[model samples]
Target: MTSPYNNKENITDKSSDVVWHNATVTSEQRAEQKKQKPVVLWFTGLSGSGKSTVANAVEAKLMALGKHSYLLDGDNVRHGLNKDLGFSDADRIENIRRIGEVAKLFVDSGSIVLTAFISPFISDRQQVRDLLEHDQFLEVFIDTPLEVCESRDPKGLYKKARSGEIKNFTGISSDYEAPLNPEIHVKTAEFSIEQCAEQIVDALIERKYFSF
Candidate 1:
């Protein structure tokens, strides 16, 4: 049987047959109508580092403030859009690439999209960053120490990785490239989830991504 991931033809076909369809209403119009600046809040960190926790909290805050927002989480996506992809390096790259495209659509629609993933590779994260405009992509690094992440181990994934039950596991069998200069870095160990979420909101406000 052929490997599902070995199809290169489908990946390389960017033809002119499909012209870009201009939407009747532009992104700026959508933003103006919604009264908020659209952005992709990409949260990257180790498993159990509170990426999902803090991201959800931030989304809640955004909603309470009447900002339009959506969250794309790792496990949730895997259950559907990325079900075919595995933990292999190539699969991981493709997974992030597809998500970047989806997030770009969300931004075009003028919604603040929060993505919580263990997106371990810096290059992959940078690729997603390049997909958006300069100010539209906010890299929020959940900067928790590896030891702390292992201790938290909410899913017991770290324990499995340590036991060699899970291969290519980030911060264990696989390598995780930390962001050298993320736009926002929240040290989960130093603050409460609400505080971390507020810190992100404060940054967004300070940058004038949205007011009040």
Candidate 2:
């Protein structure tokens, strides 16, 4: 089997002996049946930046609109699927990589997936984008300032990270490369959760994800 990333030899998972499988029903068929365009809404930001909060709100809105959707929250994922991953840079990259593959699977099944993760690295986020079609992935940047996030610190993570209790925290010990030009940018500091979520839903509706 040819590697998905044939050009990037170092990261390609090759298995010449294994056969590539195709589903009997195609993704387009599934999407048509659901009357929606499946896509991944990737929410990236620093801790306490309302990634999860806004994503949850968006998912709720999608639900109310009768669209099929799923949310993959970072902390919840680490508790199960990514339990073995640590706080190292390599682990962080692997975490996003795995999540990207999972999001692709959801998209294939005609469901909109919202992933809420710090996803601090630009390269890692780009890798996820590469896994999907042109319109299959939309980057949603929750642009909350460091001061605002630190002040909110809903999980007390910032306090711990500041006190040297947590290592490799994004926006602190680790680097958070903000999206240079994300598809959707929402500043939680300036807007309410409903407004931010509605902004995203409006974008998808304008994009014709589903006819209202």
Best by lDDT: 2
* Residue 4's lDDT in candidate 1: 42
TM-score of 2: 0.93
Each candidate's TM vs. the true structure? 0.95, 0.93
Task: Write the residue-wise lDDT of candidate 2 on 1-212 in tens digits.
Answer: 87454345544444544687998999999998889999999999999999999999999999998999999999999999999899999999989999999999999999999999999999999999999999999999999999999999999999999999999999999999999999999999999999999999999999888877
Report residue 102 deviation for candidate 2 (angstroms).
0.4
Candidate 2 — which residues are off by over 4 angstroms? Answer: 1-14
- Model 2 scores what on Cα lDDT? 0.95
lDDT of 1 at 9: 66
Model 1, residue 173: C-alpha shift (Å): 0.6
Deviating ranges (above 4 Å) for candidate 1: 1-6, 10-16
lDDT of each candidate versus the true structure: 0.93, 0.95
